[model samples]
Target: MTHPLTSLSGKKGLIVGIANRHSIAYGCARVLKAQGAELAVTYLNAKAEPFVRPLADELDASLVLPLDVEKPGELETVFDAIREQWGRLDFVVHSIAYCPLEDLHGRVVDCSLEGFQQAMRVSCYSLIEMARLAEPLMKDGGTLVAMSYYGAEKVVENYNIMGPVKAALESTVRYLAHELGSQGIRVHAVSPGPLKTRAASGIAHFDALIDAAIERAPQNRLVDIDEVGATCAFLVSDAARALTGDTLYVDAGFHIMG
Candidate 1:
């Protein structure tokens, strides 16, 4: 077998949203670290730190910080630590999204004003926030990638208000790519098919969504976290330098179905 390092060795990156070993962020971090990219990871809080800290250690992360995006100044603290430690960053992976249970399980039309706003702030605006901080630090040019989903394009049953939230996130990806392209910064959204992630567990009837994806996708199988990770590594690697302002699907052909 050919050893494909994807040429990311020595690249430094910050990964947000790693909850546990099963997180998509963890998967991406795993492959990126394997490709010899140095990593910095985050935990949402003290409780989550217990679950995420060991994985950060296993990945040999140079910096591990608390990062609750909604918490005032916490995001800045993480970036500050990155700046103090690495001086410059080559890439960043943003894989966080959230909505209140009441809003997530309800119809989009019925979603509360506060709930919708909160979801947009967390799931959509946070990318813009991160991109702003990363722009200057990406001095040598870099890539920024975020987690998105098929629900952003088409209505998936039980996805509820997140459909619109993801739609906004995808749009932000394009706008950020345009703004940052001249600086040699690439921005993209990686949309993977349904998986039993901690985030996905919040969706109502998520198991059925996964089953339908497996049955209807061209490959007739579900995508694993490692696959998602490898795709993320590709987007940030030199291999994908020319690629930006687009949503890359790693869904085993599920999105192509009419």
Candidate 2:
């Protein structure tokens, strides 16, 4: 069976925040490459090299650079590296997010100011940072996608500061889409149901949370990382040209439940 994504034979992509094969970003990278999109990836530090190196080699990525969201100059360095290697980019996937573990396992109202600031900075502000740097490289226009979750729209216990971070991310998508539309660039969010990523495991009771999601969602199962990846590939592809400034839920219909 043929995949429903647009042909990406000559396009290039930059995907940030891939830590391992189980990561949603890695899923996106895999599908995008399978569909003919040339890829570039980013790791948070040298420690991640052992994990990301094989995947980068597997995809025949144009480049793989270090990019810690909190690290000064990392984003600029990666963008410069991409520019040097590819000159132009056709798509970028912002798969990065963070929050203090203490804040995530407790009440939202109890979250510390520092925790909130850090969460927003890493999860929400990073997209803006990427957009500013990538816009120039997308001379012919391109797609920008950010990862989101159901917690941003509904109350999910143990999701705390990260929920608001996703809310800000979703809102930023609209603002960016509006600003970048004239240049023919698209911006959107892909919200997936709960899944156990290395980051997700940090949240207290994450296993029970996944069980609850599988029980309540229409599919009666947690969404696979690859499913999220495939959706991302479609969103960034040409077939999804009519879509922008929207949050497309790939959450097994969990977001729609009461």
Candidate 3:
């Protein structure tokens, strides 16, 4: 089927949290590039520099910067760079979330207060920060998209702290959508089923979890990153203009059955 949205030929987008080829954010970047949007990218630190620099080069991104969301100044720096370079941004993709592996594997009741706060900071607060920073630069109005997981809705095994974080992230999507709607900006989240990613693999029993999703899901298989990317493109495009304050699932039809 022909894609309903206009090609993002002249659009400039900021993509955060691409770790490697396996990351969903990377998939989003690839598709967005193919769709002709100019992009800017960021990685967490020097450790990921070697991995992401080549990919940013491949996309011919306008800027590649280091960001540690926990760093109070980094968010402003990144957005300032975007303002300086692009002057205005058409869209942003937020694929960042983090929680201690131990905290995610343990019971929620046992989660450390520090761990909970850290999770909320990285996984939830970053979106709020991004929205606040991006709202001004989207002078003509734009889209902000984030990646979430089914764990936010149904408690999957060992997805402890992140479940709550994703839940809050989803809520942020709606609240931001309402607040930004006046400005014509759309805010939304994409919830995908379990897949093998560096981050997802941190969970205990991750393979069994993927296999379980495959077995029980209506599609009888795991979701793919490119599929998620395509859906993201739709969300950021004009065809989805009426959609906002929503969490759209790109999970291989897996989320509906069980």
User: After superposing candidate 2, which stretches have Cα over 4 Å from the reference?
Assistant: 1-5
Worst 10 residues of 3 by lDDT: 1-10
lDDT by residue (92-202, candidate 3, tens digit) is 999998888778889999999998999999988999999999999999899999999888898888788788899999999999999999998999999988868888878
For candidate 3, the TM-score is 0.97
Candidate 1 lDDT tens digits, 12-104 = 999998998889999999999988899999999999999999999999999999998999999999999999998999999999999999999
lDDT scores of the candidates, listed in order? 0.93, 0.89, 0.89
In terms of lDDT, model 1 sits at 0.93
For model 2 the TM-score comes to 0.96
Candidate 1 clashes between residue pairs 3 or more apart in a chain or in different chains: none
Q: How would you order the candidates by TM-score, starting with the best?
A: 1, 3, 2
Clash count, one per candidate: 0, 0, 0
| Every model: Cα RMSD to truth | 1.3, 1.4, 1.3
Report the lDDT of model 3 for residue 155: 80
Cα lDDT for residue 94, model 3?
A: 95
Winning model by lDDT = 1
